[model samples]
Target: MGLVTIEKAHVASELLVLKSKLESEGVICYLRNEYTTQIMNYLPSFEVELQVSELDLEKVREIMTRKDAE
Candidate 1:
């Protein structure tokens, strides 16, 4: 399947959790933060990215719904 963005500008932690949830549900996922690495190592980093998939779009949405309810 080709990659397609399902959500954009999502928080890093949330994105990571979302990735795990999608994986658990058997949906392949990818988080692309192509510009968030411009940070000082001694300081904090805040970044966001586009979450994606071509096959897992519906499954990703489904997991998001469940996570929102929790």
Candidate 2:
């Protein structure tokens, strides 16, 4: 399946942490516009994105929900 973006963050560092967490949980993921967002911090359109396989969307959602509850 193709990749789907599951989360967006304005801060690259925060997104990086999230990516690390997802990876630790065995969910393969990628960061989109990470460098562009960092380079264009003032641009809202350049937000960092957390992307994962379409097959892992539900799992990613659950992990993010649990993280948000913390």
Candidate 3:
């Protein structure tokens, strides 16, 4: 399945939390550039990306939107 990024976090800890939240909701999530970001924390442009199957893109976005509202 093709993957699509759903969220980005500058901090590794925040990325971890987001990943955990998505997985808890039964969404298969992945962290892209996680280790790279951690190793190159000085680079502001290098942020961790949370990704999921393209089919789950809309669902993930909706969940994140509702989370932000709360």
Candidate 4:
């Protein structure tokens, strides 16, 4: 019924804020972070995914894709 989004590559606190806002607006959300993967070498700049219900996708996108916030 809802949708999900890969909001951005952000640290923990920012992700938390976004999740909080979405939940306050009656949207369920899920936070997913990339686990470390290395093949004879390690890399940085991991990935983070923000997921929301399909019905709440637009609102979540709006909050996340703010130009001023960018």
Candidate 5:
């Protein structure tokens, strides 16, 4: 299955927590540019991306929307 970027976080810690949340809900997560972003944090454009399966895109979005409401 293809992966789709679901969110971008400036810090790895943020994505770590989100990864845990998504995994608990049975959605596998992949982090892209996590280490690169940390190493190059001085650059404003670098961001850690939270990615999930393309099929899980809508499910992840729904979960995140509920999280935002809380």
Candidate 6:
């Protein structure tokens, strides 16, 4: 299955919470370059990306939207 990026965050902690939420919903989330971004914090271009299977893209977006509304 192909993966699609759902979100990008500069703070790992923020992404961790979102990752946990996605995992709890069985979306099988992935954090791309999580450690690398953390290590390269000095670089503004380096941000952690939250990704999931392309099949889960819609659901992930819905979840994020709900979370943002809260």
Measured by TM-score, the strongest candidate is 6
lDDT of 2 by residue, 2-64 (tens): 999887888868777889999999999888887887788888777888899999988988998
Tell me the whole-model lDDT of each prediction, alpha carbons only: 0.64, 0.88, 0.85, 0.63, 0.88, 0.88
Q: Which runs in model 1 stand beyond 4 Å of their true positions? A: 9-11, 34-47
Q: What is the lDDT of residue 21 in candidate 5?
A: 84
Candidate 1 global CA lDDT score: 0.64
- Write one digit per residue (lDDT tens) for candidate 5, span 1-70: 8999987988878878778988999999999998898789999899988899999988899888878898
TM-score of 1: 0.59
lDDT of 1 by residue, 13-57 (tens): 656666777778888776666345334323344345545676667
Candidate 3 TM-score, C-alpha based? 0.80
Query: What lDDT score is found at residue 2 in candidate 2?
Result: 97
Could you tell me how far off, in angstroms, the CA of residue 27 lies in candidate 4 after the best superposition?
Answer: 0.5
How close to the true structure is residue 65 of candidate 4, measured as C-alpha lDDT?
73
- Cα-based TM-score, every candidate: 0.59, 0.79, 0.80, 0.58, 0.82, 0.83
Candidate 6 lDDT over 1-70, as tens digits, reads 8998878988777788889999998889888988998788999898888889999988998988999999
**Predicted candidate 4 versus true structure: per-residue lDDT over 1-70, tens digit per residue:** 6456757554545667767877887878776663332221244566566787787777767776773387
* Candidate 5 clash figure, as a count: 0
Candidate no. 2 TM-score:
0.79
Regions of model 5 farther than 4 Å from truth: none
lDDT of 6: 0.88
Q: Enumerate residue pairs that collide in model 5.
A: none
Q: Look at candidate 2 and tell me the lDDT of residue 36.
A: 89
